[model samples]
Target chain A: MKSPLQYRILPLGDHALCIELGEIIDASINQQCIALFHQLKELAIPFIKDIIPAYASVTVVYDVAAIRKEHPSAYGFMKEKLEAMLLRIDTDQPLSHRKIEIPVCYDLSLGIDLQEMSQEKNIAVEEIIRIHTNKTYRVFMIGFLPGFAYMGSVDESIITARRAQPRTTVAAGSVGIAGEQTGIYPLDSPGGWNIIGQTPLKLFDAKRKQPVLLEAGDEIQFVAIDINEFNNYNLG
Target chain B: MSIQVIKQGIADSIQDNGRYGCQHLGINPNGVMDPVAAAAANLLVGNDLNEAVIEMHFPASVFLFKEQSMIAICGADLLAMINDVFVPVNTPIIIEKNCVLQFKKPLSGARAYLAVKGGFELQPWLGSFSTNTKAAAGGFEGRNLKKHDELNFRTVQKYGTALKNKDCEILNWKASVKNFYPASPVIRITRGSEFDWLTEDAKKRLQSDSFIISNQSDRMGYRMKGDALIIQNENQLISTGITKGTIQLLPDGQFIILMADHQTTGGYPKIAHVISADIPALAQMNAGEKIQFKLIEQQEAEDLLFEQQQQLLQLQNAISFPLLKFKQQYAID
Candidate 1:
């Protein structure tokens, strides 16, 4: 079976390729990305610094010296290598997704924009909670801040616009929903996202070997917790 | 040997080459804005070019030394003094223990670099001594320098009284500190991705109009004010990879010059990138300076960059080889 996602390996200069995945932010697209990532790792073609996978694309940064060493005078070798491997795309197999239970404290004190969102949506505050918590979010990408995962397809009922102006500082782990998107503030930074809840979980810890608790393709379930449970959940 | 700070400036922090490889995670590389000057200062002190040094913005004052060490001030004419005596720019000065080195207000330029011998040693985070202030990652405690912080200088292979004797005043040195600055505040820029989005008149204004460097500027970005760069289509695109010196055109037609500490990715359409060679000049620009961008071909920019890299490599080689030979032949007696 052919894969749902088709990627065009666009050469960026001599040392990089922008893996442009066709539009569609879904599970099938994610599977193709995960498969490609695993395939590159298994091949272990040298000179690659990293494969930075985003929502619908992955950019591979490579060392020029290594590329030249591996494919002497072959200008188009990298592109050819990537194209040849696309035929072997494992479509049948679905990669295992990790379940990350994010304990969120929905305290209005911490959730700075909860009341505003609740009022704007013309829904009860409790209904907002139910709609937000009921769905399992697919971690499409991680960006903007360190370890900040961009998970998506929040219910249309909870669609809310960002504040006209961003807050000067959004504390780390502050959960926010903007329009149809939902994400966590991975670091204490100036942000414009509509913060509705806060997770006490340390989503990003520089001291940790992996640093980021969740990666792309992981499933996230926001479990509403009391202040006691939030305080109990250790922040890295 | 350790160097003690007698007075920390308005903003001073330990910086090296920079922490790379983590930009994808949105970690800003908070290194010396003027990397060229930082490297020069490092070279003046007989340290490896990429070693850590103090990156001082205007209003910096400090006292630090290592083993009766020498230091060089490479960027900004910030009225720097060694024990109340004026220390000339671009030259190495010997400062014994207890001697005070104060950096006065900026006579010209914004940032100044201070490099001590053997480089300042700080615990590195994520394979670099450079600090990421936004992420609070590298350098001393991952923050700006405060009053009375001690910086350690690592030991280096002994090279006696060689570079120190050659030039007493840095102005007389053969280093190409001149011809670096453009005639005016003219910054060369290439066409941005959304250059076409601008109307004919707007595009003409962009090429001709003068934009004042707004005071609403910092490590993150250099905000420019003057001509509102209104676009024909104000579509918000998905944020993507951004780099230092990227001129991002906002919907309002204002420009944000991304600096060293700018976000890794941005959604704004980039107008043009400030050439790598001109980045050092941009780093030293004080607020309220009037600036204009002149379009140059990408090939020309690349060629200029290649030449600059070649020249820097030559300088590195000169200090490493010929100077080492000169020291060996002349200093033995």
Candidate 2:
């Protein structure tokens, strides 16, 4: 048995509705969102187009034309079905997790903001790397770019804000931190996150059997590797 | 029949209805910007509404059809021409072997859609033929159509009727786009989740003011500039799920409406969302164009969408019935 959660259903266009379970990004709230995500998928509502789970919400994107066939109001019917499902859902159980180890190189040459971040925070570069790699982070979401995993709760010591001036182009495999979260750039794109390191491993490969290396609800841990090791990982 | 790209004009790529069910993984649905135009083009050529179509921007690609083929050009009146002759949009036309098709100038709108009969022979990436340029997956080697690129036909051609003209023959019927696209159209929007965060004055400005689409816009999102919207709260929002047509207020006081290739999640305060029915018109609107928003109820938006879908169904029946009869009488297969 689990405590009933207080949530609000917000309208997101005519075809979709977002159920916000909580306001902030918390581990338990995210776990509940993940649990709800699986439940929504299991129901396999034919009208549902996409079920996207973020930090504290799970947005149900539905097909308006299909839902219109059965219900006069598309959002209303989905909301009713979802509310019924929520009554039977149990979020007390621990969320299913898959641990993934990612090797990263914190070399100053590759990590363009490593020295700047260290100087700004008054922490040694090695200490910053140690702080980043010391704990396992929960994958709250995968978004912004394909295969880009948004993981959370970086060590409080190194909690940093997004750069006021975002880089025009951040290289792929760049490890970045913004506020209490951390993530890798799956593709080279315009970004504002403070990059702390780089990884040689391909975060996204369309040709690979499994395109994305990480997914939401994953347990991701960073392992510090020398630049040489990073290069070797790319080769292998 | 396959098309050989003679001129690769801008970043023209292949697109379909859209790629869905992968937003959770951060992959966007990079389909045709103008769904009405694309669907009409596909239907005009006797293909499914969501079949892969060549989405072009002016100066669009000049393609040489390797064999006789029937095709339709829709969306953005780019003044499409077959050799020296003019070709109007929303009409299916049959081109003789080796005839080169080209768009000379932009008469109206922006992106143009060209869909071939029997569809193109291409493997779908994650169940869609839409190109993901950033990810470099799907739609003709996961990239835009380029010079010398040949798109093989998925099925062999077998048209029973013979063409009267040698170069090309224009079909009599045409699909009307009056309901889909209008001149000087007013876009409709619904208040976003963070709509109340806007100051009272700013809220009024959004509906009353006219914004110009910035040059920095693309399929990902449209950056608009006009009245600088001011928010009462200067709070940093946690990243949340975002959908196509979401209008987010930028830190610089401008606005950016997320489009087809929008990220699955965003941290900015969402001020409003463009009603889905108006998206077809929005997609056809080009940079340097003026746009205004009209706030409407959610029920009205849904009603408008349902009506649009109903119209599309009617179009499908109208287009396919004659096509099926023609094929029955003429198809040698």
Candidate 3:
């Protein structure tokens, strides 16, 4: 109701407001959230600290001290500005979507659970790789860890449940599957997802111009690569 | 010259003001738990607010100073003792070379900040000196301090000339920050966006209930052991950005207050938010400690933060004059 733009701005603590575009995790709602994210970036509100685009929401973390100088209530000032921006933001406007190709080596050594997965699913390891590589997945959001992208809608036939006992340390670049969801570990941290393969491309590099390889809304498809190719990656 | 670490604490890591604007990429700004105490420590030693300081947990580290420098210990009142002389918390002290500074007991507080005059000689990662242990980057090899690890000082110069031949000398002026952090503090909170998601009875129970800080807690978040808050409707919450003091209602009905190293986004129903002004007090609270949340207006929360900031700035101004005189008298500047 704060912004007549079909968006519900929820108060997140004292410094942030979550602009809910929709309740369900729909693609169009997410797109509007992402579009609004880019628009807010272009607007470059000085008081805005971060514009975080989730599945169907954009939570804006603003500077309370800075905003208070301009208006009486920090939330009121930000809510009004967000409403004004949302009114003009074109969510349906053709948004730029990047379709990235990632190469993965589905070796048993790298993918610790591949052998067990193949045996349990009654499918050959090669066929399992084929099913994984054939489809493109949309990155719903980047969360849990730095550069860790949460992608969705895994093939129903190949959907796997997360391991009951999570590994204490999951290596970075390890591709894993959690029922209806697929993601890559961007850092060496504890994880529970069933490992299927390992990617040659770095999902996150802090030194690079763009730290995270994949962003929310990007379409990504896995490509089968040999161990030699995986080892030889980035040699050039 | 570097100060040699004699005994290592549980998780003595380097921290500063923290990294910001990188949460969208999923990187959390894991900095000092107590910003107010950390700032006071830095200001006492005449260092900038962003300068790297050692965040020491109870059973803290024993540092053998290889260089004579002015230092201040703040936050958790770990019994800071040097050469058998008790170095008081929130007071700047001049220590001579070879003096071993150790925390004897956890008198109060959970984490202590050790800030030197010119700060630690450390490199920043992603524009912050705060050690992100999860990523294994930044702050002294991207990990906590270990025994025999030598930490170098940024401004390597002759210091503590006023100490004149003493092992350790407590400076004249000290910070009065006890008012900000009291024993069994009633942390203030403001209504969250999803506050109405709870039943009217649950809403009243929120204020009436007193929660205990669970052992399963860290810099990321504090899990509270309290009454289960039943949601009025079982509505699925979409993941959205959460902040430092967000109080989210978990599936089992317990609350988890997001902290310094919290995730960029979460899907749990946020019931309330610990006001920014009281976060430092909450940060000092450890396991087994009781916490009571008092609901207040958002406007009042903002005013409290403003008041805290003004008080901190006032302390900085008060310390500067005596520090300048200390430097002048000691001929260390």
Candidate 4:
């Protein structure tokens, strides 16, 4: 069994608390964060608004007034309750992974930065796509923009830094890579990531019950599709 | 029961208390920049605190009320007028049908919240009426109010018949807006998790230096131009959850404060967070305005927030007192 994880809990302000699992981004450390997130969520603590699991930390946002109504001091009460909950976290518990397959068109036209990346890494464009599609990525966090899932740990050989100057506008459904991380832009936004492919699926739909397509602790696999298949793909 | 947009000013959009419990989905809470003013406006019009209100920037919108309605303009003093008569803010005003309401050049503050009785007729996306323009979802077809865009009132008919008048009628009482204004340009901040990551000189500069809000500032964030705050160590902060009022240290050594429409998470090192009580004052700041930071303890920050909330409660009670007395005396529902 893995050793118990140690974490430091810090206040984000009066309203939220951040549980720092570790400083580094390791899969095991992230899994521990995911586990704590689930545990706290399953506890269904009153006044808790949201629990966000990131690469190395989990932020718990709560209603201060609501918490104060139950306990005389909101911060004290939250700290005490959270400290107790932290002890009960089963770090070794296996997380149930929700595997999702994303279809991508890696055509030269669609992959705007593929040629640039190939030149920089001294790797063939086709080989870059092969390595990217082969690995199963983990959702480190969903943030920056609505439904934008930050997933990661791409092959080190294909890893690249963010663009020196960010593009003014990155189209929605544009799949990009930055450093060791890869993610898809859920909305049309100005981004600095090196674009490698495009996805036809709507990653975020406000009308849907679950707006974001990917959640933390989920597994993602990219499936390569030809330009024709990408164009013909129904975006329902 | 509807108001047609005669002239859409700079970036006016419908907003409520914002979408909660959705930050995990990477959604920013795109609400009114000044919550205190929005709540006060709603309260003045006898509406719920979270009722949808129109948020307008300087040189605000010119609207034509199609039907009799009650409205409360709060936040910035935009010199609002109805039919060329000055309409006082922070007080409820009953407007007659076909009245042309216009907001002239801003007298003070940066944003003005216009709240109508019974709120606006808009569908809530992800449990909020806030318009997320980037996602193209929620509020008035997911975009800023444009010329000729009409919005219907949810409860204007009831209020119209109850307070019918040939001309615009102003309420006898008004909420005190003096408290919302910053006494000084200094804003109280609590040290963030990465506060120690900064150099000693950087930490000192944060307190000593006065920063001017850049023109690039918006609902997303307020980029401040000031002394370059250098970090002693070169550390790459992992992406993490962030909230409104978060002061993040950019790579260039300047600071940017996350606002109402800030991204849910960020990768920059968060150096400090503006206290909740001072958020309204911070929101009122216009471009080129200079501001300083005063560090406060966590307990003090909590106390300030509690005190602000208490003040709002007292204001609500004071507002309800006269209304309750009037209702009892007139025996009107």
Q: Count the backbone clashes (under 3 Å) in each candidate.
A: 2, 1, 0, 0
- Among residues 3 or more apart in sequence or in different chains, the pairs in candidate 2 whose N, CA or C atoms overlap within 3 Å are B160-B330
- Note the B-chain TM-score for every model: 0.90, 0.97, 0.97, 0.95
Off by over 4 Å in 4: A1-3, A70-72, B158-166, B325-332
True interface contacts reproduced by each model, as a fraction?
Answer: 0.16, 0.83, 0.77, 0.64
Return the candidate ranking by DockQ, descending: 2, 4, 3, 1
How accurate locally is residue B178 in candidate 3, as Cα lDDT from 0 to 100? 78
The candidate maximizing DockQ is 2
Q: Whole-model lDDT for model 4 versus the true structure?
A: 0.87
List, residue by residue over B38-149, the lDDT tens digit for candidate 2.
9999989888899999998888999998988889999989998897789899999888878899999999888999999889999999999999998999999988888999
What C-alpha lDDT do the candidate models reach, one value each? 0.72, 0.88, 0.87, 0.87
DockQ of each: 0.31, 0.84, 0.73, 0.73
DockQ, prediction 4: 0.73
Clashing pairs in model 4, backbone N/Cα/C closer than 3 A: none
Instruction: Output per-candidate TM-scores for chain A, rounded to 2 decimals.
Output: 0.91, 0.96, 0.93, 0.95
Q: Pick the candidate with the highest lDDT.
A: 2
Q: Candidate 3, residues B1-333: lDDT per residue as tens digits?
A: 678899989989999878887887898888898999999999998888768899999888899999888899999999999989988999999899999999989998899999998888887888889988887777888889999899998888586457868998899989999778756658989998789999998898888888899999999999999888888977877778888999999989999999888988888988999998899999999999988889999888887786787788899999999989988887877
